[model samples]
Target: MKPRILYLATADARGHLMRAQLLAHALIERGAEVEVLTTSDEGATFLGEFGIAAEVLSRHYAVQFDERQNMQRGATDGNVARYLFDPRHMLRDIWRLRRRIAAVDLLVNDSFHPALLVMGCLPGWRRKIVHVYGASLRRALLDNFQGRLPNWLARGFAAAISSELRRARACLQHDFAYAAPARVAPRLFNLPTPIALAQLPQQVQGPRAAVYLNPHFRDPQLATGLEQGLAAMGLQALLVGEGYAGRAGWTPRDPQWIDAAAHSALIVSAPGMAALSVAQVYRRPILLLVTDQPEQRSNAARAADLGLVHEVVCWSGDARLFAIQVQEALQRLRAVAIEEGADAGSQRARQRLDAWVDCLLELAAEPR
Candidate 1:
């Protein structure tokens, strides 16, 4: 019988869901039965689209931010206790998952707190695989270095993670780094693969541009200016992904936006892995908008350095200048034949994804 695998993920952003969906697809393709446990409705819907079963485990409340983009004081206080120690809720949810857990041969956790806790409770189940993405690992390391807790407390946390690491069958690091020679069974790169050229929609041809607006950033002036500028350039711009909900008159045009990207000449967006992966699969040149997040900045820089994209437009200040730079980037991309250059990057990305699938298959075959 094929191994039954349970995937645990926290859907703080679309990137998490996207990664889970991709990995689940890879697992299913290799004859494993996969079920995803996520923390958001959006994630559930995304998984459903791929025919993967998903159960929602938690809902994250938004934290308000100030003009400087920093979290406002007292904004998170209201939710802290519930987020940290809601045992009743956690236990109830775990009970729901208990039967499913008993049926699965292996568990694959992708940085979900409750799932991590559950894994710790499973004493003899040493076949758990933990997938650590770049952002969560960086956060853990930074928290340790910042002296955020007392020395004893810090050591305790470190010991807990170290013990978990030893128990994990394998650790899949999903970022652009050379695989470590030791300390893990199979080290795999975490990057999306390109869709097969023959499988891509034939009509998805031409020069197109994409823009991802995150409404939570609270920069209406910036968003308005960007939309107007893209329209002025007569470039076919596609906007996908959701911003904050409940904002006055803010409805996402995701369907139309997705269609636009598939047929556009160049794609422009914030450095979101999901968006970038889609653009790459469609063979579009991406113009990335840099953000405050370090991982995004790193992805943008690496993309530029690798010639996988056209340019990175940093929105530090001067909205007018930023708009001008975006326009110029679009013009440059429009002049090139994106299809001709897509081969190199697409092939490398596909190989990496294939290797990840192979690693997962090997783990599934191991004696339990």
Candidate 2:
């Protein structure tokens, strides 16, 4: 029988679905039967473009954030209250996933109900694998340490999760620019195959830059100001995101944004997994915006430290400063072509990804 792999991921964010799609494509090429179970219709639509089969496991009714950005805590108190009051909803979804687990040779999770639910229950459910980018439980622990949870409580929670981490056959930590192993598997990013890029929409000819904004905590005035500033810089900006339908001059596009990023001179957005992956693949200089979320803040810091991004700005500053910084970064990017340096980086990233895929296949081929 052919090896069958089931991928479980939250579909609310584009990053998770995109990564899962890329990996699924790779698995298919290797002759594995892959099916994705997600929670959003958009995710299913996006995956459809890749010719991947996606099953909608749950319909999420919470506040939808920018598909390109991570949702911040306390940003929607009512929504959070609803979730907290109804934990059984998530548990029920897990029960459904568990019913299908028996046929899966491997289960890959990327921050979804499956990881928190199914994996915690089956204990030996297939060979569980986790692909983590930004904003994980570790970052959460760091961010929530000072609150009502005492040190012992926090430590205990961490320990429990850590044990689960060990249970994973492999943990692929995708840092965007590069992946590092979290525990069992070496770290790796899901690098785009040249064929994948070729399959994307043809690059539009223009002085274009890709601007990504998370609509979750976005201040409309700030976004408008930033967009205006970019336009003033004489570059045609492609704003790709979930929200902002009424935002002037913004165009709606689908999965093609990944292709658009390949041709962009620069990419401006919070340091998200998908954004960072595009930056690394195309060797584009990044103008990173720090979000209020601690995990996102840490990701921005890490991107700056790695020399992958050209400039970093936090949203806490005044509008004037934000404008000035955006312009300055654009100027710097114009003077320097970071994409030229990405060839070597891209190769390195690809090798790491190949190794991870190989490890998975090898493990599956071995006798249980």
Candidate 3:
């Protein structure tokens, strides 16, 4: 019988699913049976669009956001605590997943901690287990210790999450030009951004900023001043998000992203792995929009520190002042060069994953 692999992907962000979809397809082509389990309605639907049918967990496991639309750790912990307090929800989740695992030969988790607790760590699981992470709780804790959260609290949470990561036989992190992770699990593979190569535009346009905003901070009111600021600077700004989805010269989605980037002088967006990948692919300059999320803020900061991005700004909700800042970003974009190597880095990561999966299959076929 062919080895079967089960993947539990959290619907926390669109990028996570994008990365998982690419990997899943690669594995299937390499001759393994794969099943995906998600806890997101949107993720399940998105997976279907790619011709991958995934089972949606009965319970809603979507990340809880604060009023600011940033992920709130307290709310997230409370959501997970329900399973501990209520035996029924816990048992139902376990039963459903266990039945799916009846013939599975390996477990692969894409940052889904609940599944690790429910299934991956179970005894006699019969195959190699792999854990994948796009972002790290430990990295967040270390980065935000002095700024966002108290040091003790950050340490506590980071330690807890880092401990849980050790459950898998191996861990793979999708990263790029990053500082060393705070606490890496044993047998961890700190790979580069797993972006697929694509054609980039040879001739580029000028004086336009491609705005790719995250859905979390897609509020029109918050962006109103920034929009006005861009207009004041005489630069054409095209907003790429749900609020501005599909209008003339505006693409409110990632599908239209490369085309939009081709028409832009620079890209303005929160720092997301996928957005950064888009910018990398198109070789566009980036102007970071600081948001409440630590991941985005840190990514923007780290990129700037590495000289990959031009400028990073926090919205002051003042159009006149912000316009001046936007001008500065424009100038910076023109003055610096975007570092080259993502294509080579991503290619190496793909080869590594393929080799690892092949090794696992070969081991499973060996006699005890």
Candidate 4:
């Protein structure tokens, strides 16, 4: 008999939901009976399209932002507790899922507090809580506030978030691979931003670029920059996800996104996990127009530095200069990708998932 698996993800963005879906599908393919849960109707619909119906619940996110649109660290401990990690939602979700969740043999959590709490109920069952942590809490915070905020203050916030992450058996660092070597989160393993690219075509020849935009950080200036690039090059752009100003691609549907990535010559997107994960797996050359989002900013810079991408374009001057940069970036894209760390790391993520599932099944079969 297959082990029962419950996968929970906080659908703050389509990216989180996509990761959860990918992991759940992997488990299902490995003969685990898997059920998925998310926090939003849109996320549920996304799963339904994949033929895996999902249950919805209350979720948490960062609620503190500064005047400069940066995530705040000064009052994060309290603000996160009150706003981001609201006990009321946790209580409600716990009550709603009280009966069903505890029956699962293993719980995979990607920001799903209720699943974590429920799976941690039995004496030794806490070890079955698999936490999927996106971005390194300590590393991203440090990078975001290097000279702007005092070291101690930033460290304090990291400590606070790190403490919150301790309620896991194994925590996989998604995308950025800079989790602390020891402690902080339990058994931190560096995993790629889980993308389901096993069956997709490796590459295709096309003239246009595929662009994905994050709606939260949507700026007219950035849109104009993309527009200028397209107009100058006369290359049709395929836009993905919620926000984009260029030619229409597909909605954030899985099939259309994959098709766009497979066919595009160059990929353009915010350095968010969703697009980057796909780009990493597809081994496509990319240009990132990073938002002020600290994690996105850090990921974009790190990816560019690692040679995983062609360039990071932060709009400083005007659209035309940005256009010139984009045109240059497109020209630099190699038909075949240059060898990069993200290339090897994405494969490692799949291997780790297989190992994790084997371990989970073994433990589940052991006599108590």
Candidate No. with top TM-score: 2
Q: Per-residue CA lDDT of candidate 1, range 1-368, in tens? A: 98778887766555566567767887788788888888778667756765667888767433344432334435643553465557665665656666666787666766535445445446655455555555334444334423656878877767665656556666665544322222233433343322222223335344345565543355655555566557657864455435633444344434344445555666767665555655655567777766655456556666655456566766655667767877777677667775554445445555755776676667777775
C-alpha RMSD for every candidate:
4.8, 4.2, 4.7, 5.2
Clash pairs, candidate 2, are: 179-187, 180-187, 181-187
Query: Total clashes, candidate 2?
Result: 3
| Model 4 residue 233 distance off true place after TM-score fit, in angstroms | 2.0
Regions more than 4 Å wrong, model 2: 60-71, 75-88, 112-118, 124-138, 141-148, 177-206, 215-218, 316-321, 339-353
Candidate 4 to truth, TM: 0.74
Note the Cα lDDT for every prediction shown: 0.58, 0.61, 0.62, 0.60
Q: What is the TM-score of each candidate against the true structure?
A: 0.74, 0.80, 0.77, 0.74
Segments in model 3 whose C-alpha atoms lie over 4 Å from true places: 1-3, 66-68, 126-128, 141-160, 178-186, 200-209, 229-238, 243-252, 256-264, 277-283, 317-324, 337-368
Q: Which segments of candidate 4 are over 4 A away from where they belong?
A: 59-79, 84-87, 112-125, 141-157, 176-186, 198-206, 244-254, 316-321, 334-368
Q: How many clashes in candidate 4?
A: 0
Candidate with best lDDT: 3
TM-score pick, better of 1 and 2: 2
Worst 10 residues of 3 by lDDT: 178-187
